[model samples]
Target: MIRKTFAAIALCAVISSCKNERRYDRIENAKWLIGRWENDSRAGKLVEEWSTFNDSMIIGSGMFVTGTDTVFSEDLWLEQHGDSLSYFAKVYGQNNSRKVEFKMTSSTKDQMVFENPTHDFPNKIVYRHVQDSLIADVSGVSKGQPKTEHFAMKKK
Candidate 1:
């Protein structure tokens, strides 16, 4: 009789522990994500950035931190789709009203690609993140061609 009672107690404890396990947070509630991310080259030139990601969207803007334009007016839009994030960006130009659309090609733990099929692009954008900095390059493109540059900054 004592053995049966102990088994019942063990089963109840196991079930109680399982019920107490908490689920992970939702994607939108990720606080560690909302911030600025900056990237620089070996020569110390700011290449690109993620300015900020908040309210279920990623904002990337032109980098003109130096010169007279410290805050670029143009920004790209990125948001989550399932486990992947998709981007559709415009020049976000001040008074220019120009726009562009880029769709996702692939994504991994440390890399992502965005492209527009109808637009004239050399190739997909490739990013390598190391520590707090992200490196960017374009594959399947020729020399002297313009590729997407990245410098991600998280919101302080």
Candidate 2:
């Protein structure tokens, strides 16, 4: 009986550690996003910059500029929370200037998808790394109509 109990406890410990490692690995896999990315188009210049904040978090900033005027900006964060990873965005002049939370629902070696179904718009956000570029997609229902925006940016 004593041996059986000890074996069970050891197995549980190993399983718990593996779960934690997998959670942390999600953040580690996003290390490719730790750089500056930019997209210049007829509409404006979109810029996104990301950096490591700590062992389990990454901080980012995004901006859209037209000519010499700054039109929009936002603060971004990707953080690990226990068994999950979440994405947070605090956009200027939006949601009463409060941060919105999106839980990571799917991930791969070079892609991650976060979703917040309760949000007014952009219930889904996806980030993908391809070659030397990053592609970001945001989509959801707005005004009872579906809308989606795609951004392809090169590492700067």
Candidate 3:
């Protein structure tokens, strides 16, 4: 009976450790996003700022400015819950100003992707870091047509 008990305890320990490792890996993989980025164009200037909220959370803000007028803005959050990572965005003047949650579908050393298929648009959001630039892409079906937007920004 004692031998069986020890085996059970060891198995539990291994399971718990694996869970923690997964969570840690996700948090570590996204740490590179904690910085300011910007993109300038004749249409407007886009800026995104990110900071560490805690060991398991990162907070961000983004906006677009055109000729001193702010056109778009949003609050963003990347958080780890248990062994899962999620991205949340609350865009001003959209969806009653409520936050949308997207589950992390894939992550790598320089890229992370999130998805929410139920959302009306932008069912997928992807972020990739390459050299000195950050690329963001959002895509989904809008009004029965597939659409995608891409934003490329330099570190600021």
What lDDT would candidate 2 get against the real structure? 0.95
**Higher-TM-score candidate of 1 and 2:** 2
Residue 42 in candidate 1, Cα distance off native in Å: 12
41-111: candidate 3 lDDT, tens digit per residue: 99999999999988799999999999989999999999987778999999978989999999999988899
What C-alpha lDDT, on a 0 to 100 scale, does residue 115 get in candidate 1? 69
Worst 10 residues of 3 by lDDT: 19-28
**What tens digits encode model 1's per-residue C-alpha lDDT throughout 1-156?**
999999999999999777444221122332233345554444433434453455456566545454444544456556765555556556554325666655667765656676655555534555555566555554433365655544453222
Residue pairs clashing, model 3: none
Error of 2 at 44 (Å): 1.3
Q: What is the lDDT of candidate 1?
A: 0.52
User: Whole-model Cα lDDT per candidate?
Assistant: 0.52, 0.95, 0.93
Sort every candidate by lDDT, greatest first: 2, 3, 1
lDDT of model 3 at residue 144?
Answer: 97
**Candidate 3 displacement at residue 56 in angstroms:** 0.9
**RMSD in angstroms, candidate 3?**
3.7
Each candidate structure's TM-score, on Cα atoms with residue i matched to residue i, is 0.51, 0.86, 0.85
